[model samples]
Target: MKKIEVFVEKANDGTYWGSTQNLPGGVSSYGNSFDELKQNLKAAFKDYLEVGRKLNENWVQEIEQLTEFEYQLDIASFFKLLPIKISAIAEKTGINPSLMRQYASGKANVSEKRAREIEKAIHELGEDLLSVSF
Candidate 1:
């Protein structure tokens, strides 16, 4: 079964948003809470996959097994889901370890620009991994 990576993020308005990087453009979902976001993302993903399958005959087999597709949280969401040390993420994103720790522990508020920087790093890493053929 193939895995679909979903990047979940907290929006500026305090809402949650989720989207798959592997899917075509415009496939996204939003919610007021993480639970709502999860449900919305699942439904939105299924709908998006259906539309994709309709446009591509070769996707029929995959579409038929859509239930088998695994959904995973990426980067920030992963960190939020588990108890990961901020130092590790800081090393990966090239941010100051102390500041990262503060952010992770809710001791320091991250500005939008800094948040974008962290996100950009994650996306860049994802792109690099995607370029590798297994």
Candidate 2:
């Protein structure tokens, strides 16, 4: 089974929302938290599948085979959920702290390359944490 690509964002009200890219209409869902968001997305996609099967839509075949949702977050939402200090991560990654703050707060657009850099830094941190003795 393939994974459904879901773009997630945190709303002004602090609720989480996500949507599956490309469909007859659009498979979108919202929740107050990440767990709720996944639950709602599953429900919404199930509804989408039923409708797609009924209408005999071509996209349904590929979509219905998907059992996993790959949720990618915008920078702001990522920081909000992860609770990691943007400045610290920026310093570690050699990305300007001010620019990182802007990206974290959704005040600036982050390029794909920049996003990958940030992700790499976080993953390296995770690896460092794994080396802890206890």
Alpha-carbon lDDT, every model: 0.68, 0.88
Mind giving the per-residue lDDT tens digits that candidate 2 earns over 88-111?
Answer: 899988999999999999899999
lDDT of candidate model 1 versus the reference: 0.68
Instruction: After superposing candidate 2 on the true structure, give the runs of residues whose Cα lies further than 4 Å from its correct spot.
Output: 22-24, 126-134
Model 1: residues with Cα > 4 Å off, grouped in runs: 24-26, 63-100, 103-134
TM-score of 1: 0.49
Instruction: Give the number of the best model, judged by lDDT.
Output: 2
Candidate 2: residue 120 Cα off by (Å): 1.9
User: Clashes in candidate 2: how many?
Assistant: 0
User: Which residue pairs collide, candidate 1?
Assistant: none
The lowest-lDDT stretch of 10 consecutive residues in candidate 2 is 19-28
